[model samples]
Target: MYIPELYKNENAEEIKSFIKTNSFGILVNQTQGKLWGTHIPLELETNLQGKEVLFGHISKENPQGESFTDNNEVLSIFNGPHSYISSSWYDHENVPTWNYIAVHVYGKIRIIEGEELLFAMKKLVDKYEATSKNPVKIENLSAETMRQINGITAFEIEITDIQAVHKLSQNRDDKNHNTIISELEERKDNNSQAIADAMKKQRS
Candidate 1:
């Protein structure tokens, strides 16, 4: 990612938290002269050895998985809050811009099959299903159904490089920043709320 100095975020902890908050992201890979991408919620973790790992699974029938063969690399992009800022909202002659947070992680693909797939399934279920109104118990599902679901591909990305950016009006002076924040707060949209939150965090 080519991020301007004004929008760049160098803190790893901040970027990691942003990724966790917005866990659903795009996993992109290429194979057979074609590009493929999968949009799914991924589980991110740091092991005892202090290495970052990304875990996710895809349907067996999904062609995106085929792109992640033995040695193919992959790029996973985590996009957080984003809102369009009109130049009219600012007090100066600044052109329109976007306020957003995003992280790009590049790594090698390691496919996990058979028992490993089952382990990945359990991990996913434990992470997402536990918070539901009527929590889904994977153990409650029939053995055959579980087996069928386990047929999906499970993979992990051992991230080699990571870059993140937080463009939350940090480049503007206090006056302009406050103006954009107030204008965004008046909008009844999720992105606007996020921009407001980011602005508050940055100012703090």
Candidate 2:
């Protein structure tokens, strides 16, 4: 994550909050000299030792799941809304660019199983199901259905480093930034509107 000083987001709490909101992220690592990646839902948590950790699960069939080992380094990427920024929106001449928010978390991986895996699965279900009108309880599953949980692999990552960036027209003047936001909001695409909202929140 090559981030310019103007766009870098160094606030630890803010970064953690972003990850919590956008828990579905890409987990990447190298296996047999080849790069492997998996799209998984993850959460930022504190371990019993009071250290920040990441928890997630992968399909048993995914080779990346088997590749993880104790202390193996991995990268988790969380992406936020983004859209094209036209140079015409700027008060001064500028090149077209993409504005977005992203966070890169580097950590050491540790595979988890049995009761620990069940605990992690429960946490994931509770987090997403909280917004449902009628949340489904994981414990409600029958014994046979619960046995299917073994088909997934659970893992934890102890966060070692974090890098985040919010490229929301920070290089432009107030007027130009406002122009970009207005243009984005006027567009029909939800992604554009999302970027507009992010820019507004940052400025506010």
Candidate 2, residues 1-204, lDDT tens digits: the string is 899999999888899999998989999999767888888888887654566789998878887876787328999999988899999887777689999999999999998877767777787888888999999778887899988878888888988899999998877778888999999988979889989998988888
Task: Name the regions of candidate 2 deviating beyond 4 angstroms.
Answer: 48-50
Q: Which is the leading candidate under TM-score?
A: 2
Local distance difference test values of all predictions, in order: 0.82, 0.87
Tell me the deviation in Å of residue 45 in model 1. Answer: 2.6
Q: How do the predictions measure up, each by TM-score?
A: 0.90, 0.93
lDDT of 1 at 93: 78
**Any idea how many clashes model 2 has?**
0
Q: Candidate 1: deviation at residue 181, Å?
A: 0.5
Question: lDDT by residue for model 1 over 63-169, one digit each (tens)?
Answer: 87777774469989998879999999777676898888899989888887666556666767877887889887766889887767656788878889888988898
**TM-score between candidate 1 and the true structure:** 0.90
List, in order, the clash count of every candidate structure: 0, 0
